[model samples]
Target: MSRFFSSRYANAEPYKPGEQPKGQTVVLKLNTNENPFPPSPRAIAAAAEAAGRVNIYNDHMCRDLKAAASEYFGLPAENIMFGNGSDENLDFAIRAFADDGFPLIFPDITYSFYETLAGLHSLPQVVVPLAEDFSLRLEDYRGLKGMVLIANPNAPTGLARSRAEMEAFIAEDPERLVLVDEAYVDFGNESCVPLVSKYDNLIVTMTFSKSRSMAGARLGISFACKELIDDMEIIRNSGNPYNVNSMTSAMGAAILQDDEYTRKNCAEICRVRGWFSGELRALGFNVLDSRTNFVLARTDKIGGKELYEALKARGILIRHFNQERIKDYNRISIGTEEQMKLLLENIKEVLK
Candidate 1:
């Protein structure tokens, strides 16, 4: 608390990201939902080649990258927007739509970043709670008075609602803006990108960080009607004309060109998620059905915090939220088969 600190930021509570331990120790990290595999070889080559052009500013509009995404997703470049990451895109949405009067609406136990963004912007927030099984109830969101942000295949829980359900929700309020954060959509979840052209009020944000294994590169894309995308572009250019660097832009374009690479990785992750979930259940843990590359589980024998600490002590790292309803649960990212086997062995030892 600095004596000269501004009162505007007095109540700001920043989101705490997962731990990133940097050392020589080999840690089986399942805390952050990062891809265990490396990025595509072509993407790596493109990035390496683009490194030489670092002295020049990246294309402000990210034209080539947008064109590549357009080709891949079958959406026009006019309907696409790019940012530093999906977090930035989400922040842009909050700034563009949410206000003190309009407020921001989201799931009560969804991505924590939504709350942080709302707080940063001083926007009123309406957090609608999910059903008992953590599924979104369409009726609960029938008449939201503000911008709605839904994380498809939501973080921590990793549960997803179907596209039909989402379409119905979007149809409920055509005037209200609905932002779908699909950061984990590649992992066995249906994407709302196809609906962007159909609904003028819908904006879907995705990231290359999760499935593309480019968390370090920090590339994010948003899909919507041209008018909405133009508004987001205004916000983006007003802040930073070159939000994405050349290397990232080039690499992201290359990666999008080779969709098979990410799809293969996503399939593998989903397979591992299923296997890991079953293994956790066999160990007396209650695992939630997940569509993302992570699984949310809780054990009747041990508390989440206790298990989290125990796993960390044994050179493994998993996510544990200290929130009220989910404090007992741990969110574990799906790693390779060998890594998962090691995790299961460690869990058996801990339980014993």
Candidate 2:
């Protein structure tokens, strides 16, 4: 530990993100759950135009982006908030809502960022474990008395709870705030965005990184009751008022203007995911049913660490968590058909 660091942050354990390899070689990167396709041509054009306006500060209100989001989701501008990324939105939520007195509740096996955010804010947290099959049980969360955060079609596992189940969980405690991260919802899972209007306590977050193929742009969207959104706006304005860049804002709005582009890309990813899962299962791997663009699987023949190392040696990068209960599983993002075929061929060579 550095003696120069603040005492509060000295003991903090930061989240480890996927590796970003830099070299001349072509890397088959299926580690980070990013879209393998290019962004919409319209979005690219808009971003190129906005790049010329780099001298001026971006609109702090993100008015045009919110308007585009409103048209796409059928929600008003007052009900939405944009962030540099969904991580920033999640951070704002933790900072705005979580407290030492009222604990934060989330799944033990969901996104690792929740725990990191709680630690960063120094908020008490209650982690509910998922069922043996990695599915969430609403009964487990029935009587919790704190703000809730759940990643729909959860990361690493890529399994989604039904919208009815989520609604029931939200109805369980209307007074408490519930944050639903639908980062991968465009793949196949049912979204709780429509429920924001029905339940004032619900805050649904989405990201352009996944579906819109704009991970580099770092655009995130949040939907909630106008009151809750107002509170988040206060938090955002307090920090960097111009959180998103002009290029990102313009491109994000342009991408949202064409839903078909994202839908088509998501459909192809889902198709590839299903095919990859079947191939892995046929090879004696236990592939979990995934609605997102990634599959979590483990082989009885080889350990997760071993498979990860082998894939790395072959230049096929997938994710392997060293955490308990998940050490045996590897999370592989779905790429193009050619990429998947190459991965399969490499896996065959590696296993042999």
Question: Which candidate has the top score in lDDT?
Answer: 2
Taken over the whole model, the C-alpha lDDT of each candidate is: 0.89, 0.90
Off by over 4 Å in 1: 22-26
Inter-residue clash pairs, candidate 2: none
Give TM per candidate. 0.97, 0.98
Candidate 2 local distance difference test against the native: 0.90
Q: What is the RMSD of candidate 2?
A: 1.1
Model 2: per-residue lDDT, tens digit, 233-302? 8899999999999999999999988888988999999999888899999999999999998999998888
